[model samples]
Target: MKNIIENLKEYALETIEAEAEAVSQLPGIVDDGFGEAVALMARCKGRIVVSGVGKSAVIAQKMVATLNSTGTCALFMHSADAVHGDLGMIGPGDIVLFISKSGNTEEVKRLLPFVKKMGNPVVSIVSNRDSFLGTHSDRLIYVPMEREACPNNLAPTTSTTLHLVVCDAIAMALSRFKNFTAEDFGRFHPGGSLGKRLYMRVEDVFDKTNQPRVSEDETIKNVLITISSHRLGATVVLGPDGDLRGIITNGDVRRMVENGKDINTLQAKDIMSRSPKTVDKSALAVDALRMMEANNITSVVVLDGGKYAGLIHIHDIMREGIQ
Candidate 1:
């Protein structure tokens, strides 16, 4: 049993090391062909159509997904399905990427004529430049020669890893060529933790019940009540005309008491900070958090079109996993 466990550990490590070494040699193998392929896709007017068969097909699907999420429009057409009616998904001006490690996958090679007839550029990522798919392609990006982790060199181990790395590199290059920003990426995501971090607005964080607000003329005692009631650490002070006046926080209350001031005689305006930090409710919550960080504060007053909206606490951002 101990010998079996040791063999298992060594086997896994060997697989990882083999794949890593294959990936490391990719830069040396990259040449003008890869650059031309990226330039073709970057200049493509329509979506990129990625097609492959078997293990390479799975890599193609992942590549399509990454391309779409990173601002480059893309779709996956299974090589076998493309031979059916899936070829209709390809439109004029589209770029088709054919992924095949051996460059001779029958299903992938069958689409070469159809891709050419569509008048779209066909780029092949293959290990054998002399194979049918590579010879028929308009351009070829060669994958470095890889020996599979399979003892018999038959399983798609290192080859598939290299395919993933190559696809990701192309997607990132296209992303840089288009100058895609985090905000652009957020628009596509919009559901995961990444979307929440990038797209969450101050309005989403601060709402009516959590808005600790009090009139400027309200007594310090009333201000403290609002702050404590809402549990937002501070109260937004407003004027009689509903304009922002100042903010009174628990710290202000503590300082006033420490200074031996007549807490009973003070109004909300008396102990409040006139230049309290404020954020537009429409602003990104991440940006509001940056404001809080820069000002060394824990909360800020939220305004909607220059009017008081609510209060945003640092804890609110934290709850969204922004940090």
Candidate 2:
């Protein structure tokens, strides 16, 4: 069958190289217009309305999503639908961003007149800076693509890649100009695990049932029961004033037994390691995991107001993908 798989792999590599070459030209073309486009979107009083046709439509939708997620309010409108009453979605101060490689796509050209009548500033991201949309737009950002990855030089391959990269760049620039933070990004992705990882505090992951505790005067027999019940591999030892004293792990019990001491007579003060690691309950869950790894331990004590709050185990961090 002419080794169809190998032939396909070769063609894929060639397409990637062509697209990469096209992208290599982007750096030189990024000039004052790029900054101006970002300023326009940043200064916009209303939503950013991104419109395009065909392949550009796909990029526009993705750009809209990126913009909205990173603190910029944006919406996607297909070029064909804009003239058919979707133009109602465009507000007085909204900025219309048009994405078209050719700058003369039929659907986009047809919508440009209505776009102009709406009196909003039109910014065009087009490969041909001299084309209709390019010259007519209030501001134009040029993306000069040499050719497509298509062997026939007709399909939208490298051209679409350029469109996506340009839009991503603009969206990122807007995000930076607005000083978007990770906490701000978390607000937009609260439904996903990533949001939890970024925003979930250490206290949010603490388990009440896993609070292994013992006082200094308590017996080893009492420590064993607490550690077993809590299943946290260790128990916290508190002083007479109920302050944090030390920690005794299952290994401490084993080592005490191995030392041939009278296991029944040991107290929490005798076996506990006085220097237990602790993390503030207000710390991020990810930061707690970092402390655990750095100390080569599996769990850490949680403190609130300088008092014992609870324990955060490595398992809690792993469940959140921080490991």
Candidate 3:
């Protein structure tokens, strides 16, 4: 058992070394042919159809998904499935990105003639630049061989990472070309945690119940009753015309008690935080959160176009999601 464990550790260490080398050589591999491929994909009139078999197929799917989520429309076309009416998914003006380590997977090889007849630009990622698939490819991103991490050097670990990073490079390049923003990504992935973090508006999460407010002339005793009854530990102070003026929090009560102020006589304006932190209710929840973080605040008053919108506590974001 110990011998097996030692062998596994040795193999893992070698894998890391190979992966480092691959990452280092990625830039050099991105020149020339990579430019041609990126140009073609950027100018593509239709979608990018990724095709591969076995382990390469997984990488193909990931590339398709990343590109799709980043405003570059893409779809995965299985090599085996392509022979059976699946080729119908590919049309003129679309770019086909074929992936393979050896660059000679039989399933993919079978579709070379059909791909040629369809007149779509074919881009390929291959370990060997001289393989049959690479030879016929219009553009190629060569995955440099650093020896597999496998004990026998037969598995597809290092090569796969090399391809994945290259695919990401292409996606990121296209992302810049298309000006894909966090908002665009959020639109594509609305149900995911990342979408929640980017798209949720503050108006969607704030609570309006018992939104205690007091007039500028209200005494400290009235303020205490308002804060205690609201249970939010805070109260909004309004001006003569009902405009927001200040906020009184539990912290203010503590300060008042420490200063030995006469609670029964002091007015709300004398002890409240003037020009209190506030956010537009229509603003994204994440933006509101950032404002809170930057100001060292735990809560903010929400305003909806000149009206008292609501009050948002930091904890409310966790319960209702950022959106």
Residue ranges of candidate 2 with Cα displaced over 4 Å? 1-5, 257-262
Query: What ranking emerges by TM-score with the best candidate at the front?
Result: 2, 3, 1
lDDT of 3 at 22: 70
Q: How accurate is candidate 2 locally (lDDT)?
A: 0.89
- Candidate 1 C-alpha lDDT tens digits along 200-298: 998887665666788877888788888888898998888888899999888889999999999789888888899988888889998899999998899
TM-score of each: 0.85, 0.93, 0.89
For candidate 3, the TM-score is 0.89
For model 1 the TM-score comes to: 0.85
Question: Whose TM-score is greatest here?
Answer: 2
The pairs that clash in candidate 3 are 200-323
Q: Give the distance in Å from residue 97's predicted Cα in candidate 3 to where it truly belongs.
A: 0.8
Comparing 2 with 3 on TM-score, the higher-scoring candidate is: 2
lDDT score for residue 194 of model 1: 89
Query: Deviation in angstroms for 290 in model 2?
Result: 0.6
Superposed by TM-score, candidate 2 places the C-alpha of residue 205 at a distance from the truth, in angstroms, of: 1.5
Question: Taking the tens digit of each residue's C-alpha lDDT, what string does model 3 give over 156-203?
Answer: 888888889989999999999999998888888787768878788887
Model 1: worst 10 consecutive residues (lDDT sum): 203-212
Report the error of model 3 at residue 209, Å. Answer: 5.9
List runs of model 3 lying over 4 Å from the truth.
1-11, 208-210, 219-222, 228-231, 258-262, 320-323
